[model samples]
Target: MVVFDRADDTLRHLARYWGTFRQMGDPKRSPAIAALEAVLYEGRAARIHVIYDGPTTVGGRLIPGAREQFSTGILARASAGTWQRLAPKADPAPKSSPLPGRVHVVQDGDTHPAQAVLMTDAEVADWLTATAAGET
Candidate 1:
């Protein structure tokens, strides 16, 4: 299973979804999303989960249909935060199995430096695909 972190931008980049135009700027599939979806289509990923910070409120007014956009495996901000906190920490350099159901954050200069995989989107995608296929 692959769990994306701070995936608001990724959700916004869904090519099929256009409701998030203003906030997201463009309704095109991001490179990362595209690569992942390709892998999914090719029957590579066993399970895919995208968790984002969602259901945002501005000036105490809830955004219409914000929660509805996230129909698949989307957790509310509070719930996701709690899950993240409760989730087990991943060692930066594991001696044995590299990915034993652990979170590998895809980002540059992550706040939690220890758990982050500091790599470009394409690099991360390639690594994930190779690992999933037991090619790495």
Candidate 2:
């Protein structure tokens, strides 16, 4: 889970996970809403990320989670001053991500950093296929 430190523009780049409302699909998948709520309500660091992979201890029992490297980024922002107080003092694992403090949220699908490209349905399909093939 990556807790990016976004300031307005950067916060608009990434996507947030709104739980699905049955088969109707994502009920509140709105980046704008996330950005607005996060910065306003959660402060700037009240977000969360759920990493679903490998073996993690849930309530003391160790169980391997799902494949596909699934993760969710929360837009919940706490107080900017409290980010350090609330976040981990140090990352516990080699690949662990610290609760982010302040960083730019770059646009997704950007090639040159300055230019953005929206993926077509075919591209999305190919990406999923590649991930499933373990080629990514």
Candidate 3:
């Protein structure tokens, strides 16, 4: 159970997990989600738990004496500066990358391209804004 600081990170994580699942032939098993559900259901009675600052708890014990653990990789923190840096800017449109869209979205979790990419720039911007706000 990896905890992210914002909705963007959560979306990125979902993308990465999906990419790996796809690359691995979309296994008939999903241990990660299973484990997460187990802990979530079983730990509901426990009070001692660690949490990542995000829309929900990344991983933690719902109760004491439960040995549940969640593993997460590096997740970028959400900050105004970070968002500004990652957000696509407007103006004299900067040089765009030549990489195919598939290559970019599969690279990491929260950084994956949004579904609204084909929509208007304002729509895309609004999506990012909405996601960022929801995350915090």
Candidate 4:
């Protein structure tokens, strides 16, 4: 993972807030590619956690019948298996092992209490655990 500012007082923001993830025009410089690179580099096999109401993908044009937007189409294919997975059931026990290419979308203020804005790998892991355990 790219450690932009590890210091505690630097007003840390999640990876989604990074400007590079919200850029436009160049597919080579697409935010999805950057995110996939980071995730691939981490190799944690953990689910991705997206911050709600945060910096989102900028609007882009998509040709009719195209499955994806122009800028992200290629990257989406490149990261095909790294989208998201179904939430584990909230009964019995939820799997705790790291699930590669799994993504969990959480709102900043979700109905189920969660540690919003995961800023570190540890935090993300913890949140994933809580989710697995149906604690959030």
Candidate 3, lDDT over the whole model: 0.39
Cα lDDT tens digits for candidate 2, 1-136: 3433323333233232333222355434454443434443334245544322222222222112221122221212333333322222311212223444322211221211121245888998999899999998
* Candidate 1 TM-score over all chains jointly: 0.26
* Model with the higher TM-score, candidate 1 or 3: 1
lDDT tens readout by residue for model 3, 26-110:
6433445445445545444554233444433233212222222322211233344433333323112223344433212212223
Alpha-carbon shift of residue 66 in model 3 (angstroms): 18
Clash totals for all candidate models: 0, 8, 7, 0
Query: What is the alpha-carbon RMSD of candidate 2 to the true structure?
Result: 16.3
lDDT of 2: 0.33
Better of 3 and 4 by lDDT: 3
* Candidate 1 local distance difference test against the native: 0.39
TM-score of each prediction: 0.26, 0.21, 0.25, 0.19
Residues 1-136 of candidate 4 have per-residue lDDT tens digits of: 2332322222123233454465566453435435534543343345443212211232221122222111121011112122221112212222232433333332221213122242578888888899999997
Worst 10-residue lDDT window for candidate 2 reads 104-113
In model 2, what is the error at residue 69, expressed in angstroms?
24
Instruction: Give the whole-model CA lDDT for all candidates, comma-separated.
Output: 0.39, 0.33, 0.39, 0.32
Q: Best TM-score goes to which candidate?
A: 1
Q: Is candidate 3 or candidate 4 better by TM-score?
A: 3
Runs with alpha carbons beyond 4 Å of true place in candidate 4: 1-67, 70-118
Question: Could you tell me which 10 consecutive residues in candidate 1 have the lowest summed lDDT?
Answer: 69-78
